[model samples]
Target: MDVDLVVPGLYCLRPEFGQAYLWLDGRSATLVDTGIVGSGPAITALLTELDADLDRIVITHGHQDHAGSAAELRAATGAPVLAHAGDAAAIRGERPMPPPVLLDWERPLFDSIASNVPPNPPCPVDQEIAEGDVLDFGGGARVLSIPGHTDGSVAIHLPRSEVLFAGDTIANVDELMLGVFNVDRAKAIESFRRLAELGTEIACFGHGDPLIGDAGAKLRAAAAKITG
Candidate 1:
């Protein structure tokens, strides 16, 4: 419920199917991921509350829930969208990969639905991130290419706050195991293992709640489960 004031400089914009995070670094702001299609209104409401102008939308991946509303956000704010090149197709709904979950019979049925889900027009990205590359979003916030969840999945790291916006490239992907959705099982696990080494104090996961207090310890435990 009101994650806006609680999160302070950044707030959560929970749209249908997915959630978007907003951070204000002064007059300009940065949004991490755009929710699924029809999320334009949620974003607008969040921005209005923050009273900030969005300068950029940083996509963590290309999945529909993450990029489906990218074009809309760009149109509304004229902000530049930046994503990884490997996931360009997914963002465009070109080589869209269906979630490898759902009941056995639901796969094919969902495939057809996948073809019909409205693809948000398209927006040319202003930048393509590569592994190890860091994007200084002014102030001390930066973006890191964490990959794994998708070939191009990225995470936003705020060293000043010791908070990392880890986008599904995590160890215990509880959602995937519960048959929510997943793309590459192996890659996702590997990405989680890598983060275990980050020793971040607080982790802002894309889903669920933030990992606070002993995140490094909890993440290590999750990493162990992945290895097993």
Candidate 2:
């Protein structure tokens, strides 16, 4: 994994498959996601290189790839961990991986990814957020409760910057598309539509390169395709 500055304060920690982001703010920063197990050391190293102390570790959902290192990082930094209430138990490792309804072609890929994530012990969630909740980070980021990838999946929007931290709700891996292998595809599509309506100039995804310009339009196109 390597770290690259995507924007002035947004740094993308690009991992092989999954990704994590650091929102830099002087000496303190907020981590959007934690990559799979054994990713903690690298993440901390990057944080040190940036001279940023971890202020909070915010999880976008319960998926192992997205939250695997949350406990380790939280303990390492003494930072509170936050996630949506619906997936808090799963993020804490109290619940099994949500069974996904997937296409035949996606089954093998999904299984391979699932097999690689080591089981993590329970991690306490310091706070549970929901839609309309505004976190005191990056000036302020509004939480959009977008369920589909996982029941508590969310997108964090920085209106002041027109940036959307779009977890797995929407992906730009090969193209702008809705999250694949969802537990609830319909709900995921609905969430995609909601996210499309947001005016975003930059979009950060959990599994792909970020879209840096006119992201809202791309999201709208993806939503329309999904809906149609």
Candidate 3:
């Protein structure tokens, strides 16, 4: 795992398949997402090296790559896992994950990677979060319910810092674009537009490099080109 500093108190943890972020507030830290399974030890080590204790673990959605190590990390650090109620059941293994309605072009890619993706163990969500909830991290991170990547997808916005943790609602894989593999493309597009309007200067995404400056303008530009 590679740790990249996004700012003075923010660090992005890049694992092999996905990314997780660490937000520090003095000696306490909040984890935005937990990368795929087997990422617990690395993350725990990182926290120890930084001398920051994990205060909370927030899941943007119920996807395996995003929430896979949540349970493990929670166990190791004793941090409560919080997730949206809409996806809590799925994350807890009460129900199977809802499959994405793949676009024609996405099918081939999805098929190629699906088998290699490990199944996430059932994780217990200690708190059920929702839109408008302000989490005690990054100077009060506000949760914006941005469904369509999954019914419980969300983006964490920190107005004080002008930063947004856009969890798969938008991606910067090659360039800024809407996230693919969605259950509802239209809803995802709407969510993407909503995030673009936040006007944040910095944006962090789940699958790509963080947008450090003028992120809102870039998002708006990308959003304008996205047609239903």
Candidate 4:
């Protein structure tokens, strides 16, 4: 388990293969993403140690790596689960995501991670979010619907903090890169462009190290290359 406070009140938790984040505001917190199966306990313990209240679990999408432990975490902390309606079914385990259209290089990495992910059971979604929805937590995070990584993929932007929790819509794997294994490539690119326009100072990605300081410039450059 890799646990570190990326910002004053934002902590990143990496367990085995995927990442989850804990966002703190005063005494309350919101958990973004839930790593592979069996990660709830670790997250609960982390919040307890820090004396932060677990207010809710906000899933970026329905991918198992992101929503796998939502049920468990909700049970542990009594936090509601929020997700985009387009991905609610998958998050609830009603259906499987479409097969990803991978580049040659992406396949190996995908396989390596997928093979280790345990089967995820159905999880409940207490709220369905969409574009322009504002979660009034941690000084209010505005939801930007940056679909393409998945139909309902969303990023949470905190205007007060100038921080963007970019959930797999973009990554920083070598530099800023479009997330691999997207269900819709074109939508993914469009989402990237939308994110580039946000101009945030800090970006937290689902994979790779978080980029602090002028993260928007990096995203804009990447977006321009794709659009041009």
Candidate 2 error regions (>4 Å): none
* lDDT (Cα, tens digit) per residue for candidate 4, span 136-158: 78677998888788888889999
User: How do the predictions measure up, each by TM-score?
Assistant: 0.81, 0.96, 0.98, 0.95
Clashing pairs in 4: 148-188
- In candidate 1, what are the lDDT values of residues 63-142, reduced to their tens digit? 77678889888888898888888777666656754445444665776687577656655666777866666666635666
Per-residue alpha-carbon lDDT of model 3 for 1-228, expressed as tens digits?
999999899999997788999999999999999999999999999999999999999999888889999999999999999999888999999998899999999999888777777888998999999999999988889999999889999889999999999998898999999998999999999999999999699999998999999999999999999998
Error of 1 at 154 (Å): 1.2
Which residue ranges in model 1 land beyond 4 Å of their true spot? 1-6, 97-120, 171-180
Model 1: residue 150 alpha-carbon error in angstroms: 1.6
Best by lDDT: 3
Clashes of each: 0, 0, 0, 1
Q: lDDT per prediction? A: 0.68, 0.87, 0.93, 0.86
- Which wins on lDDT, candidate 1 or candidate 4? 4
Rank list by lDDT:
3, 2, 4, 1
Worst 10 residues of 3 by lDDT: 111-120
